[model samples]
Target: MEPFKVHILGCGSAVPTNHHRPSSQVVEVRGKFFMVDCGEGTQLNLRNCRVSFSKLQAVFISHMHGDHCFGLLGMISTFGLTGRTTPLHVYAPADYATLFERQMDYFCKRRDFEVVFHPVDTTRHMVIFEDRSLRVESIPLEHRLPCCGYLFREQPSLPHIRRDMIDFYHIPICYINNIKNGAGWETPEGEKVPHERLVTPAAPPRSYAYCSDTRYIPTLHELLKDVSTLYHESTYTSHEADKAALYYHSTGEQAAQVAKAANVGKLLLGHYSARYHEENQLLKEAKSIFPNVYLTDEGMVFDV
Candidate 1:
């Protein structure tokens, strides 16, 4: 089966203006919701986009920047108000634990659900979360403070058993697991049942890379190589490249370079600086280098 979808809720950067909010996205995989960055007004964006907060299982923060995490406390508080019982897991940088806990202390309302914090390793790339369907890894990026990006790799499914073969050969249900695991079965007569005859290879897995706020760091090439989709923060245009460098942010062209170098199948650029009224120039700049580059609009859902 194909993995779940990813939705871009709010894609503006800090300096939020009337037109844009901040950074926030919803990545749904295998029927679970994983939120990334909860800037101010994120919950509203989620509501407008018709996403259910109750289904959200995890939130991944890229850094301590308010634009990336300011709405977390509010969201959790609302969850408390709604009497949520399911535990919410938060994966973020180490600093976020202190900040989030302090905010929760201000509320002081005993949460009906548990909130577990899993800090991402900012010093190096690390696999912070994994399961049968997907794995999430953190890639440290060049920022004024400790910041990181995320890579979501979908795991290939187990080989599916050929039901027809089972019925034809009168195969026992006891050996189904072995066939799914690609192990040949042995009958009581010591006859070998080849795995290939019982099962078929699974579909290839899809992958997406989310490069949070960062400067034009070339090493990201290796970290994001050949992903199905890449979402990079293009906070500035080429004219503002100097300013982006000073602020440890990336320009549209630079974002495209990373995507091109990484050989990604598609590039979705967002996190635009509030300075620009329109992002036509930014999109044009990125498209020059990467043909598959696209400007991410709020509420746009990218089905991976």
Candidate 2:
């Protein structure tokens, strides 16, 4: 079966440090790829991660900040240079449409592919994109400007077949699929087997939420319930929460508080400030509140 994965290409604040790049990530559902927050040099980061540009179905921008959207033109131009024909969809704030389109038209007018812009209202908490197996929703967040997070929810999967039950009942191969699809089996003597008995229940669906640059919003816990994994910006330590608030960012302790309140399975902290020599302080602060939290790194792949 295809796997769901999140590839972290960049995880730094506005200033790109030697240890980390700007905010960028590639989320892979099954085999389809979606880029989130394409900051400066995102195209190079994509190459560094060995992510094929051809597989990217769309790009999702969290806000209009330079650190969140500067690399979009280069990524689109590279797609054109590679001779791609399929349309590339970009979901971002409505105000970014005019400038983004103009830049693309000037730099990539000769390309064969089409760049489709989907304007997103940063204040809404509605589904922005959906396919057969996945749905992406915008998360309302508190920020200096219009900014929002994203939630990736996977659809429920089919239950597994019970081979032992089928063998015990002497069910033929033809009826095995029916059992998996919630159908019961009957022997030649007309003895019936219940659908619930033939197969175990499927696992619950998994969800992942990405919170970019934002201050702590107390009401976010209600919206983030049932999320399996949460990636929130932890731009400062607990002591500098005052500074974090002033800059519209979150401290490591604040991120952990959100994770604990939301009851998520795991929390991944990213978007660290360059002031910290290492992530030990950040990780310690978050782990003190939420034990299941982990610090994100460049080129890291997380399974959801």
> What clash count goes with each model?
0, 0
- In model 1, the runs with Cα more than 4 Å from the true position are 185-193
lDDT of each: 0.87, 0.90
Model 2, 146: alpha-carbon shift in Å? Answer: 1.0
Mind giving the per-residue lDDT tens digits that candidate 1 earns over 1-304? Answer: 7556789988899887888888999998888778988999798898887878789989999988889988988889888888789999999888767866776778735888988889777877988999987899998898887899888888888988889988877878887887798787666688888889888888778888888899999788998888889999999999989999999999999999998999999999999998899999999999999988888888899977
Per-candidate TM equals: 0.93, 0.94
- Candidate 2 least-lDDT 10 residues: 173-182
Which is the leading candidate under lDDT? 2
Model 2 residue pairs with clashes = none
Residue 199 lDDT (model 2): 88
Clashing pairs in 1: none
